[model samples]
Target: MLSDRRLFLLTLGSASLASLAACASGPQRVERPMNGDFPGIPFADWTDQEPEYLLYPGDEIEVATPTASELTRTVRIGPDGRIALPLIGSVMAADRTLPQLQQVVSAAYAPQLVRPTVEVTLRQAGPIRVWVDGEVRTPGVFEMIGDLDAYQAVIQAGGFAPTSRQDSVALIRRGPGGSRMMRVVDLRPRRGEVVPLRRGDIIFVPRSTLGELAAFFTQVRAALPIGFSYSINGSNGSGFAQF
Candidate 1:
Protein backbone atom coordinates (compact mmCIF):
# COMPACT_ATOMS: atom_id res chain seq x y z
CA MET A 1 0.00 0.00 0.00
CA LEU A 2 3.05 2.32 0.19
CA SER A 3 3.59 4.99 -2.50
CA ASP A 4 6.40 4.46 -5.06
CA ARG A 5 8.51 7.33 -3.64
CA ARG A 6 8.10 6.00 -0.09
CA LEU A 7 9.14 2.52 -1.21
CA PHE A 8 12.28 3.95 -2.85
CA LEU A 9 13.19 5.85 0.30
CA LEU A 10 12.75 2.73 2.42
CA THR A 11 15.03 0.70 0.13
CA LEU A 12 17.74 3.40 0.18
CA GLY A 13 17.67 3.55 3.97
CA SER A 14 18.03 -0.20 4.23
CA ALA A 15 21.01 -0.19 1.86
CA SER A 16 22.75 2.53 3.84
CA LEU A 17 22.26 0.61 7.07
CA ALA A 18 23.66 -2.53 5.48
CA SER A 19 26.74 -0.65 4.28
CA LEU A 20 27.35 0.74 7.75
CA ALA A 21 27.02 -2.71 9.26
CA ALA A 22 29.60 -4.11 6.88
CA CYS A 23 32.04 -1.37 7.76
CA ALA A 24 31.52 -1.92 11.48
CA SER A 25 32.22 -5.64 11.19
CA GLY A 26 35.78 -5.19 9.90
CA PRO A 27 37.89 -3.69 7.17
CA GLN A 28 38.29 -5.53 3.89
CA ARG A 29 41.84 -6.61 3.26
CA VAL A 30 43.09 -5.39 -0.07
CA GLU A 31 46.33 -6.71 -1.54
CA ARG A 32 47.88 -4.24 -3.90
CA PRO A 33 51.43 -3.36 -4.89
CA MET A 34 52.75 -0.30 -3.09
CA ASN A 35 53.29 2.78 -5.21
CA GLY A 36 56.52 2.41 -7.18
CA ASP A 37 57.41 6.07 -6.92
CA PHE A 38 56.77 6.29 -3.22
CA PRO A 39 59.76 7.90 -1.47
CA GLY A 40 60.24 5.07 1.01
CA ILE A 41 62.04 1.78 0.96
CA PRO A 42 60.19 -1.48 1.45
CA PHE A 43 60.71 -2.74 4.98
CA ALA A 44 61.89 -6.13 3.78
CA ASP A 45 64.61 -4.56 1.66
CA TRP A 46 65.90 -2.12 4.32
CA THR A 47 69.34 -2.64 5.80
CA ASP A 48 70.83 -1.07 8.93
CA GLN A 49 74.09 0.63 7.99
CA GLU A 50 74.51 2.92 10.99
CA PRO A 51 77.91 3.70 12.42
CA GLU A 52 79.10 1.80 15.49
CA TYR A 53 78.69 4.77 17.83
CA LEU A 54 77.48 8.21 16.83
CA LEU A 55 77.55 10.78 19.62
CA TYR A 56 74.32 12.39 20.76
CA PRO A 57 73.66 15.57 22.75
CA GLY A 58 73.46 13.98 26.20
CA ASP A 59 76.47 11.69 25.83
CA GLU A 60 79.31 12.23 28.30
CA ILE A 61 82.83 11.81 27.07
CA GLU A 62 86.31 11.98 28.57
CA VAL A 63 88.71 14.24 26.71
CA ALA A 64 92.12 13.22 27.93
CA THR A 65 95.33 14.93 26.86
CA PRO A 66 98.23 12.75 27.94
CA THR A 67 100.77 15.34 26.84
CA ALA A 68 99.16 18.12 28.91
CA SER A 69 97.50 16.43 31.85
CA GLU A 70 96.02 19.69 33.17
CA LEU A 71 94.00 20.15 29.99
CA THR A 72 92.26 16.78 30.47
CA ARG A 73 88.61 17.08 31.45
CA THR A 74 85.31 15.21 31.26
CA VAL A 75 82.39 17.03 29.68
CA ARG A 76 78.97 16.15 28.38
CA ILE A 77 78.00 17.15 24.88
CA GLY A 78 75.47 19.99 25.31
CA PRO A 79 72.14 20.23 23.56
CA ASP A 80 73.83 22.42 20.94
CA GLY A 81 75.96 19.42 19.90
CA ARG A 82 79.16 21.01 21.17
CA ILE A 83 81.53 20.46 24.10
CA ALA A 84 83.45 23.30 25.75
CA LEU A 85 87.16 22.64 26.25
CA PRO A 86 89.81 24.58 28.19
CA LEU A 87 91.60 26.44 25.36
CA ILE A 88 89.72 25.69 22.13
CA GLY A 89 86.31 26.74 23.60
CA SER A 90 83.28 24.98 22.08
CA VAL A 91 83.95 22.18 19.54
CA MET A 92 81.28 20.26 17.68
CA ALA A 93 81.05 16.73 19.09
CA ALA A 94 77.76 15.18 18.06
CA ASP A 95 77.58 12.95 14.93
CA ARG A 96 81.35 12.51 14.94
CA THR A 97 82.95 9.17 15.69
CA LEU A 98 85.45 8.90 18.54
CA PRO A 99 88.50 8.89 16.29
CA GLN A 100 87.18 11.75 14.20
CA LEU A 101 86.54 13.87 17.29
CA GLN A 102 89.98 13.02 18.64
CA GLN A 103 91.64 14.36 15.49
CA VAL A 104 89.52 17.52 15.58
CA VAL A 105 90.44 18.21 19.17
CA SER A 106 94.13 17.50 18.55
CA ALA A 107 94.19 19.92 15.63
CA ALA A 108 92.35 22.60 17.62
CA TYR A 109 94.88 22.46 20.47
CA ALA A 110 97.98 22.09 18.28
CA PRO A 111 98.91 25.77 18.60
CA GLN A 112 98.46 25.83 22.38
CA LEU A 113 100.49 22.73 23.30
CA VAL A 114 103.28 20.56 21.82
CA ARG A 115 102.25 17.12 20.41
CA PRO A 116 98.63 17.97 21.24
CA THR A 117 97.54 14.35 21.26
CA VAL A 118 93.92 13.89 22.47
CA GLU A 119 92.14 10.64 23.34
CA VAL A 120 88.36 10.79 23.43
CA THR A 121 86.50 8.03 25.23
CA LEU A 122 82.78 7.68 25.67
CA ARG A 123 82.07 7.66 29.35
CA GLN A 124 78.30 7.34 29.08
CA ALA A 125 75.91 7.19 26.18
CA GLY A 126 72.53 8.95 26.13
CA PRO A 127 69.16 7.32 26.30
CA ILE A 128 67.87 5.76 23.08
CA ARG A 129 64.35 6.94 22.21
CA VAL A 130 61.86 6.34 19.39
CA TRP A 131 58.55 7.99 18.43
CA VAL A 132 55.44 5.86 17.82
CA ASP A 133 52.38 7.61 16.50
CA GLY A 134 49.06 7.19 14.64
CA GLU A 135 46.42 4.50 15.23
CA VAL A 136 48.11 3.20 18.36
CA ARG A 137 46.32 3.05 21.68
CA THR A 138 49.01 5.14 23.33
CA PRO A 139 50.98 7.32 20.93
CA GLY A 140 54.10 8.99 22.29
CA VAL A 141 57.87 8.79 22.57
CA PHE A 142 59.39 5.80 24.35
CA GLU A 143 62.89 4.92 25.44
CA MET A 144 64.42 1.82 23.93
CA ILE A 145 65.80 -0.39 26.70
CA GLY A 146 67.28 -2.76 24.15
CA ASP A 147 66.89 -3.78 20.56
CA LEU A 148 63.30 -3.41 19.35
CA ASP A 149 61.71 -3.80 15.93
CA ALA A 150 58.98 -1.69 14.40
CA TYR A 151 56.32 -4.16 15.53
CA GLN A 152 57.64 -4.44 19.08
CA ALA A 153 57.79 -0.68 19.42
CA VAL A 154 54.14 -0.44 18.49
CA ILE A 155 53.27 -2.99 21.12
CA GLN A 156 55.04 -0.82 23.68
CA ALA A 157 52.82 2.05 22.58
CA GLY A 158 49.80 -0.09 23.67
CA GLY A 159 49.43 -1.94 20.37
CA PHE A 160 47.53 -0.90 17.28
CA ALA A 161 44.03 0.54 17.38
CA PRO A 162 41.08 -1.30 15.88
CA THR A 163 41.17 0.85 12.78
CA SER A 164 44.92 0.58 12.26
CA ARG A 165 46.17 -0.54 8.86
CA GLN A 166 48.67 -3.02 10.17
CA ASP A 167 49.57 -4.24 6.72
CA SER A 168 51.15 -0.92 5.83
CA VAL A 169 52.86 1.05 8.60
CA ALA A 170 55.32 3.82 7.85
CA LEU A 171 58.73 3.99 9.49
CA ILE A 172 60.54 7.30 9.12
CA ARG A 173 64.22 7.65 9.90
CA ARG A 174 67.03 10.14 9.39
CA GLY A 175 69.17 9.17 6.44
CA PRO A 176 72.71 10.17 5.51
CA GLY A 177 73.39 13.92 5.29
CA GLY A 178 70.38 14.53 7.60
CA SER A 179 67.86 13.63 4.90
CA ARG A 180 64.61 11.89 5.82
CA MET A 181 64.13 8.23 4.89
CA MET A 182 60.89 6.33 5.20
CA ARG A 183 59.97 2.64 4.88
CA VAL A 184 56.70 0.77 4.64
CA VAL A 185 56.46 -2.15 7.05
CA ASP A 186 53.88 -4.93 7.36
CA LEU A 187 52.98 -5.76 10.97
CA ARG A 188 50.21 -8.25 10.33
CA PRO A 189 50.30 -11.39 12.36
CA ARG A 190 52.23 -14.40 11.02
CA ARG A 191 54.06 -12.19 8.52
CA GLY A 192 57.30 -13.16 10.29
CA GLU A 193 59.16 -10.06 9.21
CA VAL A 194 61.27 -7.97 11.55
CA VAL A 195 62.05 -4.32 10.83
CA PRO A 196 64.63 -3.36 13.41
CA LEU A 197 64.27 0.14 14.85
CA ARG A 198 67.10 2.60 15.39
CA ARG A 199 67.33 5.51 17.77
CA GLY A 200 65.05 8.43 16.78
CA ASP A 201 63.06 6.22 14.39
CA ILE A 202 59.37 7.09 13.93
CA ILE A 203 56.77 4.34 13.61
CA PHE A 204 53.51 5.73 12.22
CA VAL A 205 50.53 3.41 11.79
CA PRO A 206 48.08 4.85 9.32
CA ARG A 207 44.36 4.31 9.83
CA SER A 208 44.17 3.15 6.22
CA THR A 209 46.53 2.32 3.41
CA LEU A 210 48.42 5.41 2.24
CA GLY A 211 48.47 6.23 -1.47
CA GLU A 212 51.22 8.84 -1.33
CA LEU A 213 54.11 9.44 1.05
CA ALA A 214 53.67 13.21 0.85
CA ALA A 215 50.02 12.89 1.82
CA PHE A 216 50.99 10.67 4.71
CA PHE A 217 53.10 13.44 6.19
CA THR A 218 50.14 15.83 6.14
CA GLN A 219 47.92 13.27 7.83
CA VAL A 220 50.57 12.68 10.50
CA ARG A 221 50.82 16.36 11.30
CA ALA A 222 47.10 16.60 11.81
CA ALA A 223 46.71 13.43 13.84
CA LEU A 224 49.56 14.14 16.22
CA PRO A 225 48.32 15.16 19.67
CA ILE A 226 49.09 18.44 21.37
CA GLY A 227 52.64 19.18 22.57
CA PHE A 228 54.02 17.54 19.44
CA SER A 229 55.14 19.50 16.40
CA TYR A 230 55.48 18.16 12.84
CA SER A 231 55.79 20.03 9.56
CA ILE A 232 56.25 19.20 5.89
CA ASN A 233 57.31 21.32 2.93
CA GLY A 234 55.82 20.15 -0.35
CA SER A 235 56.56 23.35 -2.26
CA ASN A 236 60.34 23.17 -2.53
CA GLY A 237 60.52 19.79 -4.35
CA SER A 238 63.16 18.73 -1.88
CA GLY A 239 60.60 16.40 -0.21
CA PHE A 240 62.29 17.02 3.12
CA ALA A 241 60.14 17.57 6.22
CA GLN A 242 60.62 17.98 9.97
CA PHE A 243 59.01 15.72 12.51
Candidate 2:
Protein backbone atom coordinates (compact mmCIF):
# COMPACT_ATOMS: atom_id res chain seq x y z
CA MET A 1 0.00 0.00 0.00
CA LEU A 2 1.22 3.47 -0.79
CA SER A 3 2.03 5.66 2.16
CA ASP A 4 -0.46 8.46 2.82
CA ARG A 5 1.93 11.05 1.39
CA ARG A 6 2.58 8.93 -1.67
CA LEU A 7 -1.11 8.31 -2.16
CA PHE A 8 -1.86 12.02 -1.94
CA LEU A 9 0.84 12.79 -4.49
CA LEU A 10 -0.53 10.18 -6.85
CA THR A 11 -4.02 11.59 -6.57
CA LEU A 12 -2.78 15.11 -7.23
CA GLY A 13 -0.78 13.91 -10.23
CA SER A 14 -3.82 12.20 -11.72
CA ALA A 15 -5.91 15.36 -11.33
CA SER A 16 -3.24 17.44 -13.04
CA LEU A 17 -2.99 14.98 -15.92
CA ALA A 18 -6.75 15.03 -16.31
CA SER A 19 -6.81 18.81 -16.42
CA LEU A 20 -4.12 18.82 -19.08
CA ALA A 21 -5.93 16.23 -21.15
CA ALA A 22 -9.04 18.39 -21.10
CA CYS A 23 -6.98 21.35 -22.30
CA ALA A 24 -5.64 19.29 -25.22
CA SER A 25 -9.16 18.91 -26.58
CA GLY A 26 -9.51 22.59 -27.44
CA PRO A 27 -8.04 26.04 -27.02
CA GLN A 28 -8.27 27.29 -23.45
CA ARG A 29 -11.22 29.61 -22.85
CA VAL A 30 -11.97 32.16 -20.15
CA GLU A 31 -15.01 30.74 -18.37
CA ARG A 32 -16.07 34.05 -16.81
CA PRO A 33 -16.46 37.27 -18.73
CA MET A 34 -13.83 39.88 -17.93
CA ASN A 35 -15.92 42.71 -19.47
CA GLY A 36 -12.76 44.01 -21.19
CA ASP A 37 -11.16 44.86 -17.89
CA PHE A 38 -9.07 43.00 -15.35
CA PRO A 39 -11.08 41.58 -12.49
CA GLY A 40 -10.45 41.77 -8.69
CA ILE A 41 -8.54 44.99 -7.87
CA PRO A 42 -10.36 48.18 -8.67
CA PHE A 43 -9.01 51.36 -10.29
CA ALA A 44 -10.29 53.53 -7.45
CA ASP A 45 -8.24 51.50 -5.03
CA TRP A 46 -5.04 52.74 -6.66
CA THR A 47 -3.39 55.42 -4.62
CA ASP A 48 -0.27 57.54 -4.83
CA GLN A 49 0.64 56.90 -1.21
CA GLU A 50 3.40 54.34 -1.03
CA PRO A 51 2.71 51.32 1.13
CA GLU A 52 4.68 51.19 4.37
CA TYR A 53 7.32 48.49 4.63
CA LEU A 54 6.32 45.74 7.01
CA LEU A 55 8.90 43.82 9.02
CA TYR A 56 9.31 40.11 8.29
CA PRO A 57 11.15 37.21 9.88
CA GLY A 58 14.95 37.25 9.32
CA ASP A 59 14.90 41.07 9.22
CA GLU A 60 17.44 42.76 11.46
CA ILE A 61 16.10 45.83 13.25
CA GLU A 62 17.82 48.20 15.57
CA VAL A 63 15.69 49.20 18.54
CA ALA A 64 17.16 52.24 20.24
CA THR A 65 16.25 53.80 23.55
CA PRO A 66 17.96 57.16 23.97
CA THR A 67 16.91 57.55 27.62
CA ALA A 68 17.94 54.02 28.53
CA SER A 69 20.95 53.27 26.41
CA GLU A 70 21.51 49.99 28.25
CA LEU A 71 18.19 48.64 26.95
CA THR A 72 18.90 49.51 23.36
CA ARG A 73 19.85 46.64 21.10
CA THR A 74 19.59 45.32 17.57
CA VAL A 75 17.78 42.04 17.04
CA ARG A 76 16.66 39.97 14.13
CA ILE A 77 12.97 39.11 13.99
CA GLY A 78 12.42 35.44 14.73
CA PRO A 79 10.23 33.05 12.77
CA ASP A 80 7.47 33.60 15.31
CA GLY A 81 7.36 37.27 14.38
CA ARG A 82 8.75 38.47 17.66
CA ILE A 83 11.79 40.28 19.09
CA ALA A 84 13.08 40.00 22.64
CA LEU A 85 14.02 43.12 24.56
CA PRO A 86 15.43 43.83 27.99
CA LEU A 87 12.25 44.87 29.84
CA ILE A 88 9.52 44.00 27.35
CA GLY A 89 10.43 40.37 26.69
CA SER A 90 9.20 39.01 23.37
CA VAL A 91 7.19 41.55 21.33
CA MET A 92 5.40 40.87 18.10
CA ALA A 93 7.29 42.75 15.37
CA ALA A 94 6.50 41.09 12.07
CA ASP A 95 3.89 42.66 9.77
CA ARG A 96 4.25 45.94 11.61
CA THR A 97 5.58 49.14 10.06
CA LEU A 98 8.66 50.72 11.58
CA PRO A 99 6.74 53.48 13.29
CA GLN A 100 4.11 51.04 14.43
CA LEU A 101 6.74 48.78 15.96
CA GLN A 102 8.43 51.70 17.64
CA GLN A 103 5.19 52.64 19.30
CA VAL A 104 4.59 49.07 20.40
CA VAL A 105 8.05 48.64 21.91
CA SER A 106 7.82 52.00 23.62
CA ALA A 107 4.45 51.12 25.13
CA ALA A 108 5.74 47.82 26.40
CA TYR A 109 8.62 49.56 28.21
CA ALA A 110 6.58 52.48 29.47
CA PRO A 111 6.09 51.19 33.04
CA GLN A 112 9.80 50.36 33.50
CA LEU A 113 11.16 53.64 32.27
CA VAL A 114 10.39 57.28 33.14
CA ARG A 115 9.73 58.36 29.57
CA PRO A 116 10.30 55.62 27.02
CA THR A 117 11.23 56.62 23.53
CA VAL A 118 11.75 53.67 21.23
CA GLU A 119 13.07 53.93 17.71
CA VAL A 120 12.98 50.97 15.37
CA THR A 121 15.10 51.05 12.27
CA LEU A 122 15.55 48.45 9.61
CA ARG A 123 19.20 47.49 9.66
CA GLN A 124 18.81 44.77 7.03
CA ALA A 125 15.78 43.44 5.27
CA GLY A 126 15.02 39.75 4.96
CA PRO A 127 15.14 38.06 1.63
CA ILE A 128 12.05 38.75 -0.49
CA ARG A 129 10.72 35.44 -1.78
CA VAL A 130 7.66 34.18 -3.65
CA TRP A 131 6.18 30.74 -4.29
CA VAL A 132 5.56 29.48 -7.85
CA ASP A 133 3.84 26.16 -8.33
CA GLY A 134 1.58 24.11 -10.60
CA GLU A 135 2.32 23.59 -14.29
CA VAL A 136 5.60 25.45 -14.00
CA ARG A 137 8.83 23.88 -15.15
CA THR A 138 10.41 24.49 -11.75
CA PRO A 139 8.01 24.97 -8.85
CA GLY A 140 9.56 26.26 -5.66
CA VAL A 141 10.21 29.33 -3.55
CA PHE A 142 12.43 31.88 -5.28
CA GLU A 143 14.08 35.04 -4.02
CA MET A 144 12.53 38.01 -5.77
CA ILE A 145 14.79 40.74 -7.12
CA GLY A 146 13.52 44.22 -7.97
CA ASP A 147 9.95 44.63 -9.23
CA LEU A 148 8.24 41.53 -10.58
CA ASP A 149 4.81 40.69 -11.89
CA ALA A 150 3.02 37.36 -11.86
CA TYR A 151 4.14 36.58 -15.42
CA GLN A 152 7.74 37.63 -14.75
CA ALA A 153 7.88 35.48 -11.66
CA VAL A 154 6.58 32.54 -13.68
CA ILE A 155 9.39 33.13 -16.19
CA GLN A 156 11.84 33.04 -13.30
CA ALA A 157 10.51 29.56 -12.53
CA GLY A 158 11.45 28.42 -16.06
CA GLY A 159 8.26 29.75 -17.65
CA PHE A 160 5.04 27.79 -17.82
CA ALA A 161 4.89 24.12 -18.69
CA PRO A 162 3.36 23.10 -22.03
CA THR A 163 0.16 22.01 -20.31
CA SER A 164 -0.21 25.19 -18.27
CA ARG A 165 -3.50 27.04 -18.65
CA GLN A 166 -1.83 30.31 -19.54
CA ASP A 167 -5.09 32.21 -19.73
CA SER A 168 -5.94 31.61 -16.11
CA VAL A 169 -3.35 31.92 -13.34
CA ALA A 170 -4.03 32.33 -9.66
CA LEU A 171 -2.24 34.95 -7.58
CA ILE A 172 -2.58 34.53 -3.86
CA ARG A 173 -1.50 37.36 -1.61
CA ARG A 174 -1.71 38.23 2.04
CA GLY A 175 -4.55 40.63 2.60
CA PRO A 176 -5.06 43.05 5.45
CA GLY A 177 -5.48 41.48 8.91
CA GLY A 178 -3.84 38.16 7.90
CA SER A 179 -6.49 37.22 5.37
CA ARG A 180 -5.51 35.48 2.12
CA MET A 181 -6.72 37.19 -1.07
CA MET A 182 -6.78 35.35 -4.39
CA ARG A 183 -7.11 36.79 -7.88
CA VAL A 184 -7.27 35.12 -11.27
CA VAL A 185 -5.05 36.80 -13.82
CA ASP A 186 -4.77 36.25 -17.55
CA LEU A 187 -1.17 35.74 -18.63
CA ARG A 188 -1.70 35.09 -22.29
CA PRO A 189 0.80 36.65 -24.69
CA ARG A 190 0.32 40.23 -25.89
CA ARG A 191 -2.31 40.84 -23.28
CA GLY A 192 -0.34 43.94 -22.36
CA GLU A 193 -1.29 43.46 -18.76
CA VAL A 194 0.61 42.54 -15.63
CA VAL A 195 -0.42 41.66 -12.12
CA PRO A 196 2.22 43.02 -9.73
CA LEU A 197 3.42 40.56 -7.15
CA ARG A 198 4.73 41.20 -3.67
CA ARG A 199 6.93 39.29 -1.27
CA GLY A 200 5.47 35.98 -0.01
CA ASP A 201 2.96 36.01 -2.86
CA ILE A 202 1.98 32.66 -4.40
CA ILE A 203 1.70 32.27 -8.17
CA PHE A 204 -0.15 29.13 -9.19
CA VAL A 205 -0.55 28.19 -12.86
CA PRO A 206 -3.40 25.79 -13.34
CA ARG A 207 -3.50 23.06 -16.00
CA SER A 208 -7.05 24.08 -17.00
CA THR A 209 -8.99 27.30 -17.08
CA LEU A 210 -10.51 28.14 -13.75
CA GLY A 211 -14.30 28.23 -14.15
CA GLU A 212 -15.73 29.69 -10.96
CA LEU A 213 -13.33 31.51 -8.67
CA ALA A 214 -14.83 29.86 -5.58
CA ALA A 215 -14.68 26.32 -6.95
CA PHE A 216 -11.19 26.85 -8.31
CA PHE A 217 -9.93 27.76 -4.85
CA THR A 218 -11.28 24.47 -3.52
CA GLN A 219 -9.71 22.49 -6.33
CA VAL A 220 -6.37 24.24 -5.88
CA ARG A 221 -6.26 23.67 -2.16
CA ALA A 222 -6.95 19.95 -2.58
CA ALA A 223 -4.66 19.51 -5.56
CA LEU A 224 -1.69 21.14 -3.86
CA PRO A 225 0.45 19.27 -1.39
CA ILE A 226 -0.15 19.33 2.33
CA GLY A 227 0.71 22.56 4.17
CA PHE A 228 -1.06 24.66 1.55
CA SER A 229 -4.09 25.64 3.62
CA TYR A 230 -6.87 27.65 2.05
CA SER A 231 -10.31 28.78 3.27
CA ILE A 232 -12.73 30.99 1.39
CA ASN A 233 -14.18 33.79 3.46
CA GLY A 234 -16.25 35.41 0.75
CA SER A 235 -16.03 36.70 -2.79
CA ASN A 236 -16.24 40.12 -4.35
CA GLY A 237 -18.30 40.51 -7.49
CA SER A 238 -15.11 40.88 -9.51
CA GLY A 239 -13.62 37.40 -9.24
CA PHE A 240 -11.73 38.09 -6.01
CA ALA A 241 -11.94 35.79 -3.01
CA GLN A 242 -10.62 36.22 0.50
CA PHE A 243 -9.42 33.03 2.12
TM-scores, all models, native as reference: 0.64, 0.64
Which ten contiguous residues of candidate 1 have the minimum total lDDT? 3-12
lDDT by residue for model 2 (124-146), tens: 99878787877889887777789
lDDT of 1 by residue, 121-209 (tens): 99998768787877899997787898898889999999999878677676666555344444556798777358888887777676643
Error of 2 at 154 (Å): 1.2
Please report how far candidate 1 places residue 205 from its true position, in Å: 1.5
List pairs with backbone clashes in candidate 2: none
Counted clashes in each candidate structure: 0, 0
The regions of model 2 sitting more than 4 angstroms off are 1-50, 174-181, 190-192, 209-243
Query: Clashes in candidate 1: how many?
Result: 0
